[model samples]
Target: MSAVQGLIPQPSGLDREDDVLTAEGLTKTFGTRTVVDGLSLRVGAGEILGFLGPNGAGKSTAIAMLTGILPPDRGAVTIDGLPLGGRTARTAKSRIGVVPQEIALYPSLTARQNLRFFAGVQGLRGAARAERVDWALEVTGLTDRAADTVSSYSGGMQRRLNIAAGLLHRPKLVFLDEPTVGVDAQSRGLIFETVLRLRRELGMSVVYTSHYMPEVEQLCDRIVIIDRGRLLAEGTRDELVAPLGDGLLRWELPAGAPEAVRRELAAHGRVESEDTPGGTALVITAHDLARALRAVTDLAVRHRLPLTGLRLDRPDLESLFLHLTGRAIRDGS
Candidate 1:
């Protein structure tokens, strides 16, 4: 059994209900501008829900509201059926672990000391505290370095320790905001493995927010895309990408490629043109890949437009983001 599995008992009875978190009509505004508007979401137990949005998309505001750090202008949030505020809110908050985008830790403290302090804050004490501190170290692969001060650790090691600190008390749900930021490939892989173990071994629910498309695509069971204070789409990757037809076919043409050629390619599928450093590029969302390729090649030959470069790409989360938000996720960030 994993360290998490060995530490926490299996949840039963009412805890088995799938919906671990529910937010209804959440809205947040600052001054004259509304940041998060009428946002609602649901995350089931043991599920990793990817929260995606471009910069200034109100992703931060929405997370604050959901975590009860900021009160929403309108809406209600409940964790494990416990509403936000009053005694119930405390109870609800106690069951949550939040690992922020920035590392929140005492640089002077050793890894074990940090976990012990955080665990105490969560009400773990005596033998329980010691056990949890040990478990956090073991699960995060920091057991050997438990005595070393956090300031001496590398960026990735500090990030791992941050996660270990949050898991000290073994909260039922976790909010990981860009946890893998600034880490190397090995550390990123370790973080991914740890997250997978959280759900697989301990049945913990996770709310993951990141600008990286591939991480969301690989880790999340379902994804929600939000932009300009509104939700654009929410579903599994396959479900969201299905409506864009098949894959994308892209061609590079000499600058000022004839408008007639553009129109002709549009006849094949949905076409969008952009001026690039090399030349003008035409992208076609193809329903029939074979037919679209043949038509484009034949047209290029007839028009005497040399095909500088050509590539066919399968539909993915990045494509879906571009289609829905009208811009690349990285560009906005």
Candidate 2:
């Protein structure tokens, strides 16, 4: 089995017809800087949409606008066919759940207590609230540990409880922001199963944000990538990676090798070189991997130069992301 298959169940081919959530021309600005610009997307019923961007990509700002937590400078959000503002704000808010990146559970409270509190906040009361609390606990696989203090639970358990808190009201749409940040492998697997079951059994729609590429590739029905708060690309895994071609060829050579080698390899494809721990790494992007490999091999044999390492990697989301957004590390919002 592939690495992704081991992490997530195969797609269930859920029929997602009408959209449960839609955002149009969403724009947000802080002082002179426009954080999110003309951002727009939609989520279909029972569909999982992968929301992606690098750090400081305005993704959080866009999400805030989508959830009605922060008002967009200009845009409209419709939830379940209702505008997510004014008289319908309460109704629209109730139909969606937000699982923030940070754990929102009270460490001092028991898991059950936390659920009961959030349930009440959602206007759930009496036996209805009790029933929902029980349902949330069961859905998150925390029934056995409902009475335990959240402070005592493992990081993964706390993460699950955080998810349960958002689920008490059984919203039609759920936004999960990096739901598996710090957890053991077992917990991550369980979280994946829980998310899949939500869509499979309850037909819930989800907008998932994660820095982990494999999770997004395995879990999302469609993907939307943003940078600087603007849409860069949106498509399925194959469609998104197709533009970059079949694969990349990387060769590790001595740091001070003659410039002639670099110039020669450039003829085969788009060649780029950068410093690496192994040595100076030469990366080639080409439409045809076989043709590029043949040219690279002939050049290497003719030169009779020692190669530290060489690898041919299939095109993937990570490559596409760096290609679109550049490789510079982003530290601020």
Candidate 3:
């Protein structure tokens, strides 16, 4: 199968007034099991949106429905205000490119050959097909090795070729599913550059999904997190992390904290009791670290509580993920 499968090519102009893609109340069920339940999101033109979910979060199922590869039991997908299925589906798909998690290429074929094959799949013909093939090679930095067979290329080169295969027609929106997996740092960095270029140079929108937290934090304009097939959160990094508080202040009390001390600290922040090897500790989450620390110290001194140990933690995406889903973003659920 082709690495990236898409429909008829259309004009490259993007509609800036409306979102590039929007899925409303998407639901999918297989027999008695439901993998995706009312999942919905939007992608703006020239924006890179990060889609994050733990394993078995129905992300793949949602993507299939959004791409028109699978039918949704309930819900609708619109691309540039056109419904994603039925008569307008072809036009809607023309704006999309997909770089799948797996490397999609025929090992025996040369890089150029692989691109030509996929370009044909995208309905390019004659001079247009040849031009697009060259453009894809140049964009992916594979022109120098275009004639080399896929099996002879390094892992990074193959990944770049796989990406190039999906983008032959200069799609307006691309869905990149873990494009950097198993790639070297150089290739990964190159992939980042390519994604950024697609947006800067072509005004393309991107939906990026990866288990790597740093990649999503570094690239996406907004982030959407889902778990158990349900939408849990969506927003910019600061927006999502804000509600979790600014930082965590942990204080180990040589003797268990008194109820009055806990109550006094609660006025400053949310306090939780944690069992530690040394003893019980009070972990407080607050927006202002300096004020929270001073409050803790004052209360401890007033209540005659001895502090055995102390630690502080800043809030970040990983902490937000754990706070919401309680599961680290792993490959398998």
Residue by residue across 104-190, what tens digits does model 3's lDDT show?
A: 999999999999999999999999999999988988888999999999999999989999998998888899999888999999899
Cα lDDT tens digits, model 2, 1-333, are 212222222233223348898888899989999999988788888999999888899988999988989988898999988889999998999999999989998999999999999999999999999999999888889999999999999999999999999988899999999999988889988889889989998999999998888888998999987888888777788777765566778888876666787898777767777678756878877768898888777777887766548878778888767666664223343
RMSD versus native structure for model 2 = 6.3
Give the C-alpha lDDT of model 3.
0.83
Which stretches of candidate 2 lie above 4 Å from their native place? Answer: 1-17, 250-283, 300-312, 328-333
TM-score of 1: 0.84
Which residue runs of candidate 1 sit more than 4 Å off their true CA positions?
A: 1-17, 250-267, 271-283, 301-312
Query: Which residue pairs come into collision in candidate 2?
Result: none
Model 1 score (lDDT): 0.83
Stretches > 4 Å off in candidate 3 = 1-16, 249-261, 272-283, 290-312, 331-333
Instruction: Write model 1 residue lDDT over 140-165, tens digit each, in one string.
Output: 88899999999999999999999988
Question: Against the hidden true structure, what lDDT does model 2 obtain?
Answer: 0.83
Model-by-model lDDT, in order?
A: 0.83, 0.83, 0.83
